[model samples]
Target: MSNCCSSSSCETTHPKKHRCPANGSEYSEVSARTIAHHIRDALRWRPTANRYFFCDDPACDVVYFGDDGSTILKSQLRTRVGVKELSNDELLCYCFGITRGDFIANPANRDFVMAQTKARLCSCDTSNPSGRCCLKDFAKPEM
Candidate 1:
């Protein structure tokens, strides 16, 4: 799938404004379209025969499956999907897109992991002064 913002024009007139989907939390999937896009994004990386990433936004609290396969394979992702310890093994895992399961050595995969993490951290929050959110904590976590 193309990037979440790809031709999405999910953008709004007010840069900080985030459209909340009626289905769930303002930070999570605001609509079916958002969910679909994320699922597609997850599917784009699954190299195995039938592996998938599961995304449940803390904002929305609604669990949706990034089904690279027919069904939601939580068992597989939680059980089989892992940080590929073996050398030169093609794999993929979803740690909310922060960690890449593909050996953690492949340059392209490294970029992908970084991008995902960045995207997740991208401002989608509506609680900020700008009515948007961010993954990174500008403030100290300990404070």
Candidate 2:
């Protein structure tokens, strides 16, 4: 997938103001066309009509929104969906059955895990409880 904001036009244009549907947090706009195809497909976005808005609030469930005032997609909405606020002991790499504790135990293993993920060898998109790639989640520093 392409970088989240690699397009020149996206860089030059000012982001439109919007609010998160989940938490009413304000955010800058991002064109749906500029986001990765997989993300767009997963969100089922209509590029022409819906402008994308990203929310960084961890407590908020809605991550992306449409300019039409619709919630296009969400993350960390429910535990059943496999999106949860992970604790230190919780598993981090569902595809390979790796946990945060496992990574702490063997920090060197991170590289191997990342390589497998990058190669798409790990079935995170399907197997992961969140129904999304684990790499981005893993990359975040533990809180």
Candidate 3:
């Protein structure tokens, strides 16, 4: 499974459900292979685990898991991956290194940025820290 942020169709047809042991928050399963590639160093891949989960809570860092019901902590996870909520100074566009502050400071640039992203002007799949596209998050009205 590709990262959900990569494209509009990243959602699973039948998301495997699990309750977070750390937070009791319900989460859907994602591909272990995808998670492994995203956080290769952080994850201790379990041969028995077929799926993994990502805790979207910014306050939580329990990002990766395995089939054997194990998890990887935030400290083990990669930094600057854009998986966490963007701090004011953090890059929203990992490919172009555009920060949230840049957009807030100049709202007009948002459209231009969106246009560039929609046109596939950059290699987001390879360049993005999350190994996904920014458009799904960037194009949100709340952003």
Candidate closest to the true structure, highest lDDT? 3
| Arranged by lDDT, best first | 3, 2, 1
Clashes of 1: 3
The C-alpha local distance difference test score for the whole of candidate 3 amounts to: 0.62
**Winner by lDDT between candidate 3 and candidate 2:** 3
lDDT of 1 by residue, 1-143 (tens): 35646665655532322223323222322233323333334454434322222233322322333222233332333222222222223223334332222333443554544575567743322112111232222111321
> Of the pair 1 and 3, which is ahead by TM-score?
3
Error of model 2, residue 22, in angstroms: 2.2
Decreasing TM-score order of the candidates? 3, 2, 1
Worst 10 residues of 1 by lDDT: 125-134
- Each prediction's whole-model lDDT (CA): 0.31, 0.59, 0.62
What lDDT is reached at residue 10 by model 3?
53
For candidate 3, give the lDDT of residue 92.
67
**Which candidate leads in TM-score?**
3
lDDT of each residue in 13-103, candidate 3, tens digit only:
6456677667778775655554555565735644466666656556676775554678876666565555466577767677677777776
TM-score of model number 3: 0.61
Cα shift from native, residue 91, model 2 (Å): 3.2
Candidate 2 lDDT over residue span 15-131, tens digit each: 566787778878766555434432534465445445666565656666556677776444322222222445556666777877776777877667888899778698764455434
